[model samples]
Target: MTHLPRRDIIALGLMTFALFIGAGNIIFPPIIAQQAGEQIWLAAAGFLITAVGLPVITIMALSRMQGSIENISRPLGHVTSLLFTVVCYLSVGPLFATPRTATISYEIGFSSYFGTSSSHLFIYSALYFFVVAWVSLYPNKLLDSVGHILAPLKIVLLAILGLSAVIVPRELFAPAIGHYIDHPVSEGFISGYLTMDTLGALVFGIVIVQAIQSRGVSDPKLITKYAVIASLISGVGLTLLYVSLFKLGMLSHDIAPNAVNGAVILHAYVQHVFGNLGGLLLSSLIFLACMVTAIGLTCSCAEYFSQLTKISYKLLVIVLIIFSFLISNLGLTKLITVSVPVLSTIYPPSIVIIILSFFWTFWNKPQHVVIPVTIVAFIFGVIDGFKVAGFSKLLPDFIQHLPLSEQNLAWLIPSFSALIICIIIDRYND
Candidate 1:
């Protein structure tokens, strides 16, 4: 059994880190910190739980299963397996996360110059995805293209931005507002969902496995071990990155108190300290950050679909990238609006499956425990999606009263209840 050399392992870790730390991840921490103000620590910690913690757990779990998300769902049933796989791939791939990368890069790199709604948005997005498709056309070079070149460039640019923040500063401290004043942790945990890291993890796991296997690490245990280490490396790198951004956000309120969102917070700070040149530098960093992630996701999605169908991965990349290009025309805000309900519906069940996959080995007749709870979670998740879209009048008031419903955690109580009941049924059946 051959082990990957130290350099290969480190390269893989860096590549994994780079894959996870996309432009969207770069935006959230500062904005959250800007809101949390002096309480940024607690809020950021809570945010890290889902953002960093879940993604790490997700990767680790995937590594244990040799990186096949389909394997994790194999116990559920064929229809369930295929349905979840397709939904997970489509939702995170072309339909939502993938296109948003192009839109966001356009927003950061070109929006100010061209205006977000300018005729140039389409042109910019077309160029962006074109590059994404090109880079992703050769999946085998991912370790070098992403791990060595892109990751290092992104980290250097971010380090410069972070160091500059330390030297120039925004303001000493910003005050906590709204929910951050009281339930900083809870709100932060909830807000972490917006990062979408958890959802991305399920899809990314397979990609990580492929990358590892490409490195000549054929042992399953070694693959799992290396993957877990890489996820930790990714988590640690993101945490450091987020801390720097959050620190900047804590100081930024005095300079740009009117900042509405993360992108605004980021742009305001970079432009303030660096000026026009700084803004341009920031634009490059944003583009590189988004581009690498788009490449990884495109490759992963194409790989999955290619396996599912008789189509080749290369052809699938072209098809998916073109489809993603079309979706990019929908614009970022519209894409986000559509994604929220879809995410709300799917995320609950996705989280449940992750938990079940982690613990199902200890259960007797694990299918009894997995299927019923997943079905219940799925049903409730859809209803919750309707509620989020102003169709709440269709749901019973009782559901609205579920514990933590006010915090949008309404699925917790019922899901847990279903899990317990299913376990009992499994035991009875046994």
Candidate 2:
């Protein structure tokens, strides 16, 4: 019969927002904006759909399913659900997103001061993960540590930078480049995959729920209600932040014309506008953004693995931290190179599971529809992954002719076709 007061819910929402706006969310928009140029708004719209919309929807789904990815994915059967859940945890955990948080904070925040030598990166990541470990080891304190304190600080820094981007005058936007010139919307949509928020949402589901439970709210209805409200707050925050970053990227061409990534564009813009003090502001912002996310990931990963293997949560945190540190040493550019294809392969299936879970009550035989659609999505998703990794020859020629193939969304049509067919079968059998 417990009910969380209004402020507790707001902090819970901010904690969720802080968890989602990690390295990828902060870094990707600027690069997308810079490249999409005059087509930036079109691209931004696409990015928002996946980055903001999908994650919000995901949290809503998780809310109903009692904040467990396993619950939502249970229709896939035990082994398949276990495999899928483990892969998702690893993908957004130590293997990719978590480590990227460290590498990015270093490169964007401190790399200028310390220089980008491999030794420097190693030193910084070591210190970074140490702090992540400290915070993550005590998940019970997350609402206070992250939600009330860290999230607010991160938001203030972001607000300062976002306002600067909007209010400052700069040169005209650069011309649209590459696929962005013609397929800006789809390109932006695909690029949103790079943010990995949807995957993060799956992993963070329990974390959000636990944060609410920590406040003594035990009613399932209240839990779901609070979780949905948190997601809405986070969604609105992400939308505003992304819009400003897109504008920031468009204005940065004159200052960082040859930038390779959003980090470079962000660094240059801050320096051009704020000078030495800007370095301080940028570093503070990056640290807060990356650190909160790293803590959330580390906490979530440790908690899951501990249950799966019955190991000590603290030990898992240490092991995962070390592993993530080693992988992060591969550095930012290389990590992105390695991750894009993997993400491409996995994202379609994950998206299918999340979106379809909403209609679980509608179908008597959810497995029939879920399994077939998932398989089709994963098959074409792997083909798209191969294409992204420059291994297109490994794929048959017909894949190239798939609708939306050029956008790396070649899986869409066939997946839906499979879903429709399965739905018909499910209904007829019923």
Candidate 3:
């Protein structure tokens, strides 16, 4: 069995971390800390659970199943699992995430220098996806190209930002506001969940496994072990990054008291502290972070679709790149408006499937238990999506009163109920 040398393992871990640290992951923590204020740590604890914890758990789940979403979802049956896998891929691929990477990287990294006109965005995305396509077309070299090269560059930029957050002077902590005033943990959990890293993990799991295999490590046991190690390393890096961003946000209250979003807070803080150099630093950081993530996503999506449709991998890469470039031109605001609801719908079910996969062996009929629970989770997930899309009034009054419904977690209790009921049936029927 070929083993990855120590240096290779670290690079692989760095690559995994880079894949998870896209635009949303970086922006979210600061805003979360701003709102949590004096209760920042309390809220951070919750944020880390979903943002850092859940994604790592997801990687672990995929590791045992050889990093295939199709394999992990096998208990859902063939057709259903295929549908679920397709949705996950599209959600994290061209439909939303992949495109958003371009828009955000442009907005945060280049818009100030190049302007935010449609043509400007189109040109940026054109060049952006061009690079993504170039790297993605050669999946066999990802370990060397992405793991060794791009990941390290991204980490260096991130470290500079993280260090600045600690060393810079800033305002006093603001008071907790809104839900964070009383329900800090839960509110933070929701914020972290909305980052969509868990879903990203589902898509990126295969990429991580392949990166390991690229190092000539073909042993199944060694692959799983390395995958879990990579996840742990990524998890630690994410936790540290989030904490630093949270600190930056907490101290930014004075400079950006009326900040509407994390981007506003980040912009103000960086310019205020770093002077003229801040813009360059932030832009470079965002670009590297988004670029690495985009490459990973593009590679993963093309790999999956090529296998599924029996199309040529090179052709799929070109198609996905062109599709993502067009979608990104819709601009970030509209992309976000459309994506949030769809993400809301998918997250609960994804969470359900990922968490419950580990316990399936205990059930006499794992399919009976897993399938119903997943279905119930998906049904409520759609309701949450509707609520997010501003169609709450269209829902019944009772939905508003469900446990944790206000937190967009109405699926939780129902999914648990279905799981227990199915387990009982499995026990008795068996």
Candidate 4:
């Protein structure tokens, strides 16, 4: 009988936290706080729901199935499962989130210390992805590399910064701004979409399963228990950090009232509180955070592509690194702008899948209810996708009038309503 020690559980939890806290996770909360002002708690509620709750639920759900995403979609049949898997991989991989990690480390970390020029970005990304490609070639080592070494370093730096923001006062916070005045929680929820951790969690579940197995924890129940522990650790850590960052933003809005984005807000806050050393701390934190996420995404992408194409993992790693490096040089803002439409299209359906995966057996009709609901969600998802791309402005007035449409959750009702309809039809037949 193999016994997994308490240290192993803690290490897994640490790595889980590290993997989840990427560039977007680090950047968004403060800006939301800044906008929400005195309404910080209300806004934080919404942010944590998607940012913390969604990812935790996702990991726990996947863990129960032994962390195989395909198991969740098996009821959808093979072809659809493959397509869903590909979209998930691409969204978290080179097409959007992966590239943004490098760019963010440069923008928020390096650009703060150095200057933000294209040549500097070019050199930085090449060096960054080279390291990612190197570490990712061996997936078995991530628990040690990320869990023991990198994760702690990231945790410590963020802890120091987060605490300082709490202890010091930059200025009195202003009133809730704009939409935060009327819809703090909903706006915060919508803002959490920018983090995209839920989407990443679906892919990272595989990484967690592989790492746990590498440690000889093979029983599905034990693995799921440990994964649940890891997820709780991640959820608690993320929620605390977000609360701290939101406080900082609330207090420092005067310093960056018209700043371009959250990066600028973070830079100003860190520098004001800690001085030159603060900037160095921030740089190190971003580097470590981005590096871990890059490694995780790189491995996940390489592994999935290798399985899909029958190519070697080594070859896929090299290809993904090269592609991500090229795409990352597009810079953070450009990459985000390009990603909005794609994220809009995929994220709603991804959420639906996570929810359905959990409730699949709840009604005993996974095949009948889940697939139809997902298709309807995706259809409405495409509509929201176009709205994100700015092409859906001409959409009929009725579309804008749907419940929760203002917060970009227009698909929630229709998708769930479809499931209910399916359930009713099945019940009558039974």
In TM-score terms, candidate 1 sits at 0.95
What TM-score should be assigned to candidate 3? 0.98
Model 4 Cα lDDT, one tens digit per residue, 272-382: 777877788878888988999989888888887887799999999999999999999888879988898888888887888788887766665677877898898998888
Tell me which of candidates 3 and 4 scores higher on TM-score: 3
User: Model 2: per-residue lDDT, tens digit, 1-430?
Assistant: 8998888889998999999987668889999988888899999999999999999999999998777888899899999999999999999899998899999899888888999999999999999999999989988889999999999999999999999999987747778999999999999998886677899999999899888888888899999999999999999999999999988988888899968988888888888889989889989999989999989989888888898899999999999999999999998989989988898899999999999999888998898899999999999888988898999887778878878998888889999999999999999998
What lDDT is obtained when candidate 2 is compared to the true structure? Answer: 0.90
Q: Stretches of candidate 2 above 4 Å error? A: 169-171
Candidate 3's displacement at residue 348, Å, is: 0.7
> What is the lDDT of every predicted structure here?
0.84, 0.90, 0.90, 0.85
- The 10-residue segment with the lowest total lDDT in model 3: 166-175
lDDT of 3 by residue, 1-430 (tens): 9999999899989999999998788888888888888989999998899999999999999999888999999999999899999999999999999999999999988899999899999988999889989899999899889888999988998888888888876647778899999999989999999999999999999999989888788999999999999999999999889988988897778888857888888888889878899889889889888988888888889889888999998999899889999899999999999999999999998998999889988888888888888899999999999999999999999998999998898898999989889888999998
TM-score of each: 0.95, 0.96, 0.98, 0.96
What value of lDDT does candidate 4 attain over all alpha carbons?
Answer: 0.85
Clashes of each: 1, 0, 0, 0
Clashing pairs in 1: 171-251
Candidate 1 — worst ten consecutive residues by lDDT sum? 165-174
Residue 294 lDDT, candidate 2, scale 0-100: 88
Model 1 spans with C-alpha error above 4 angstroms: 166-171
